[model samples]
Target: MTGTAKGMIGFDWAYCRALAVGVQDGIADEDVERWLPEARKVHERILKERESGLLAFWDIIEDEKVEERVLEIAEHFKGRLVDNIVVLGIGGSALGAQALFDALVSPFYNLTTRPRFFVLDNIDPLTFSQFLDMVDLGRTVFVVISKSGTTAETLSQFLIVKERVVSLLGREALKKHFVVVTDPDKGVLRSWVRESGVLSCDIPPGLGGRFSVLSAVGLVPAALLGLDIRELREGARAMAALCETASVIENPAYCNGLYHVIADLDKGKNIHVYWAYSDSLYSFADWLRQLIAESLGKKVGEKLYGPTPVKARGVTDQHSQLQLYREGPNNKIITFIGVKSWPADVDIPPAEEESLADAGYLGGKKMGELFHAEQRATAWALAEAGRPNITLWFPQVTPYTIGQAFFLYELQTVFMGYLYGVNPFDQPGVELSKKMTYGLMGRKGFEEFVRYL
Candidate 1:
């Protein structure tokens, strides 16, 4: 938190020491503060360049049209009897939606105020086939998302869904059962929207898939959940404003980014674990896995960079991975996420009988209390064992707070990209693997890439 802590979320690095991480392992405020000037310089340049309209994600927080379009599209099918929302996307296209769905939606949404939601991000044959067999096409709407509109796995899923819809409900069902979120100007999906009259929304041009969840890619799903999508963006806009502040040390985004880089480069910690105590929050870590790994895991002038991102849930991972974190390779900086309050809680209830006396200590306590108690204990254990860790506290889980968390980490990752001297916007390594897949799948122009094999 350094000097810029926001109420939407509280950053506690107390065990990261008084100002967050202490001089443990030779790291302290002095170590991280020294990078502030460089951070300030980077921010000034990026902010100036951002005005040139180069960073689409940064601008989305203020773009009302994107939200308008998403809500408009959501109502088209949402007004009907739609029962399921199956997102056909992969990587960036899928992770953001998954994060939002898991974080903001109820664990039992299908049993309550909404429809069942699924993200078909992978093309594993068995999983894909089983998913298709599981949902009713008549009551389902397939949301196809691909910024380029030519993503292989997504397009394949779309084709199969479209064919099934066409066979069951005829070609007329296409407009009602399918909606596409893709490039506005040009792409296969764009052209399809025009020619086929399928409902569609534009993902702002130049908005990389990873950073696009704030755009149509995420809002489309948020809209489906009947969430206050505007409030979500408002949270993001607020965080963006904080990240844009003049002083780098006063901004959580910059300070957090600088320290992680400090840990990786100066302390030789190459793994960063995002361990969340809430099950609903596990998806954000999954999303971060892609965001940090894909954005910073780059080769710059022959040196491979970036801390490997690992996702863990407290209590579950407390039993599973905490041992390694405490005694394994002392090469990780774990970031623990905890909720300040549970939206709803259940009492532990006194043990049924004396036979269950071993659990009597928790009789009157709320489950959330126990949940966070374990989280607190885990952080203390790690820090005590000399494993550096940080915590992000959510006052409560809501669309607005969820938005703030997304922007916080996304901006932090981008700032870390600058400190590492790489273009966070591009992923040439992922692109190479994509081309190889296209070649092996028999795409026309990718024939040459297959030769590399």
Candidate 2:
């Protein structure tokens, strides 16, 4: 699992190839070919947009300034005895760092040599209070992230934490313990940093919060944990290059989007399930949920479209949801994500009893072995039941492989947006909710909307 493979992530669409065909439900190899030329054109156009700076997120890996700043900050905290890092931001801000920490580091990371990471992305007072008790305030570092610096949830959390730091160590101590990641020239956070002399970093202009992983938002926390940030960017940069090919068959990202859209539009398969077989990857499913849900669920003029994205864990979801997935409806397209090798494994000892003979087949088997068996069995069963499923194979789960995954999915999302004829970068529905919250909270401009309440 530790060995570094150049292209560790893979995509398999065989079960999709086995699907029932027609104008409504089947995806022949020809359908993939038919869609390739147009998808290629769209891919090329997106690259053009990147070149002109219309899409800032895609250019993150190639930005030398971002990498330099991230590395510099990482170096500052590298050998220091910083015990805990509390990251304050919701959605994109928190999920990316959480996914990286979960996938690349050990589950028992805090107890090990790695600095403990606490991502505060919610407003649960009890949970927030509990975290304060879990770590010593003086030994902890706070990374407050908000691209706009106006997100109410993030600012509220920052206020509570800032007050505690100020009271415990005085206002001057904030300079040593806190760092703000926000817009460089604007936002309340930037102003605060300027006035208080706190250290800070800028989230690249035009980069959305969800796509800020390769930017300072995600890299800061990852670098602090001793991960190879450069290698992670290299993996993403390589994947981005590979996905630029004109042939859809050669581009995994393009192919992935094509199948999902075909299944959703042609067939009645509207539920898109992202089933990851690794416990470490469960949070990654959450990250993808936001990415897919926010990016694709939109309207192109009068047409309303977008497949529902569902997150399910392997082996665990087998017991809970497999029955419905198998017998209930032919409405779901399952994407199985699995690892070829795990960092460590445990062998199941044999049952030393006469009555346990029925379960003897599992004895002396590695946990990962059984996990893969279940995955294959599930795919086989679904195929037999006339269900369509695809597999995303990961040779190993390292920072490099994860970076490849992030870029691959991001590219796939953009391709899907083109297929659906919608802008993938904006979240108008989410903004409406934000406006409502601002009105309810008595924010200045949103006061007019409060009348409805």
Candidate 3:
């Protein structure tokens, strides 16, 4: 019983108006309008580069055969070789799959669905030991993802799993139990795949791990979970097509990023807080955090660019963080994500006790009504307190809307980078740490990095 089939997600900026939040807190159209020229240029650059192998994320579905192959592979694996699926990866490798699983799959998917899913994204020893005790080697298959094929956390875990599997079931088990997503031509994983004859997928070269969610990095795990990877592609494709223009007035990503640019440069709002109102969306919010922090938070020579990103859940964070957001420094901009229509709901029965009238006010209402009310109240309260905020609405959490969201935020981060005069793609700051870890682990060539540690 949805009101109407608007079928698209949208935003509400009324709370961000000067009339609502005051002149100092709210932004006029002119504030963002001044930033539009540069936004359009960035938009143009994205559109131009989307097909040129520079922005591979935009052209994720450019080849129809890619989905065809993904579906074929998914069909072969879902009902056949898989009864329990495990993903061995971290950061963008693991987060995209986790987000998609949490959002699109049932909350009790392991108990109800054919394949029980798990993502071992960390290296906690007890956690790994417990996971091994829980899974059946004969029925479980692993999706190992690493573009470079040598991520320390992921590779070490893979080594441990390999030894356990080999000792229990012999080396033959490796071919049947493991599937890899990595570089096509280079890296230790690629070489291992060629030698061991393991089933594998190629992560596109130009796409970084953070932006690789749309490629095989995300698609393989999605296929394993029996999700509609095609619909996900369609959603992203639709958003990408809609955002092909150079006008920030017409493009949602450019328009949204422009608002933030103005907030950062003109209003000194350096903290971007995202309040996701649903549990399913929390992982996506985390994905956005890494995307923003890694892509936009860079220093070239002497100047650092990019705002700090903060994430919170709706009613839960309201108790813990809302007080600070409401009364603390006015240097943060907040975005709330709300679901316009929920897939399920329960009606609250009328109160049995006469004196429990305080609680009885919520009787006979849909449970979602309270959830929606809390979000509405939070927005109202934030606005009244002159804290600038906006809501990004999802008609429902589907593969399409989720895809649209990932693309939107990725594009927005890119726009922020262009406006801030920084390269949003590479993360040079993270490389030194990787080198130091390798040296500390006694890898052959990185010994000099040990001194820094």
* All models, RMSD in angstroms: 2.0, 2.5, 2.2
Residue pairs with clashing backbones, model 3: none
Task: Write candidate 3's Cα lDDT for 118-166 as tens digits.
Answer: 9999999999989888888888888999988889999988888888888
Per-residue CA lDDT of model 1 for 288-365, tens digit only, reads 999999899999998989889999987798788988998998898889988888768998899979899999999999
Give me the runs in candidate 3 sitting further than 4 Å from their true place: 1-5
Best by TM-score: 3
TM-score of each: 0.95, 0.95, 0.96
Candidate 3 lDDT: 0.84
Give per-residue CA lDDT, model 2, range 314-387, as digits (tens): 99999999999989888989999889888789999997798999889989888889999999999878877778
Which ranking of candidates, highest TM-score first? Answer: 3, 1, 2
As a whole number from 0 to 100, the lDDT of residue 417 in candidate 2 is 90
Which pairs clash inside model 1? 13-16, 14-17, 16-20, 16-21, 17-20
Evaluate residue 331 in candidate 3 and report its C-alpha lDDT on the 0 to 100 scale. 93
